[model samples]
Target: MYSIFGVAWFSDPRKLFALVRQRLNLGGVFVFSQPPGSLGAYGLQGMYKGGFAGPAMYTYRFSYTHAMWRSLLLSAGLRRSRDLLHEAPKPDHIGTSDCPSRVPE
Candidate 1:
């Protein structure tokens, strides 16, 4: 499955990663992109206020270091197949991971 600029919206990344791992078929991959922690607070509050003419809303947008991403993926029974963070367009970091054939116990 591919998630572009969407993973950060997950408040609970561990649960999200586990769900993705469980749904993948053998040889499947999970690819996603989001702003890295280095980029600092990137969230929807500005958009909500500007577009909807509403007060700033509370939302979850999680960012992590490269090492943190690796650990999270491993715990969810996935392995980092490739890291396209360097090649990602400005301000976004892309990560690619391969799912194991079976979920870890």
Candidate 2:
């Protein structure tokens, strides 16, 4: 029994799957939710779209389609039992939006 909520950024399903495979007790279910697309990926694409060069420090890396994400999880040996994807409107962003600044915290 685990619950993950409102992760700060996109989750690599492969990593999550690995953790689940190794740590989940028998009969346990891992519940996690991520935004439609990773914020980091979107930010990088936005920068490149606006003619800004991408740096080597981009943290979030992911494809723009569901198939790509699914492939990543499947390759990691996770079977997709169920899922829900939607094209909802974007919410007003808050806090530090300088996602690609490459500055250490």
Best by lDDT: 1
lDDT of 1 by residue, 4-82 (tens): 6665345466888888888987677777766455355432232232355577564456666667777778888877776
lDDT of 2 by residue, 13-88 (tens): 5565566556655434544444455544532232123234575343443333455545544564445455554334
| Count of clashes in candidate 1 | 0
C-alpha TM-score for every candidate:
0.66, 0.43
Report, for every candidate in turn, its global Cα lDDT versus the true structure: 0.61, 0.41
Runs in model 1 deviating more than 4 A are: 39-53, 87-105
Q: What is the lDDT of candidate 2?
A: 0.41
Off by over 4 Å in 2: 1-12, 38-64, 86-105
Tell me the TM-score of model 2: 0.43
Clashes of each: 0, 0
Q: Weakest 10 consecutive residues, lDDT, candidate 2?
A: 96-105
TM-score of 1: 0.66
Give the winner by TM-score. Answer: 1
Error of 1 at 33 (Å): 0.4
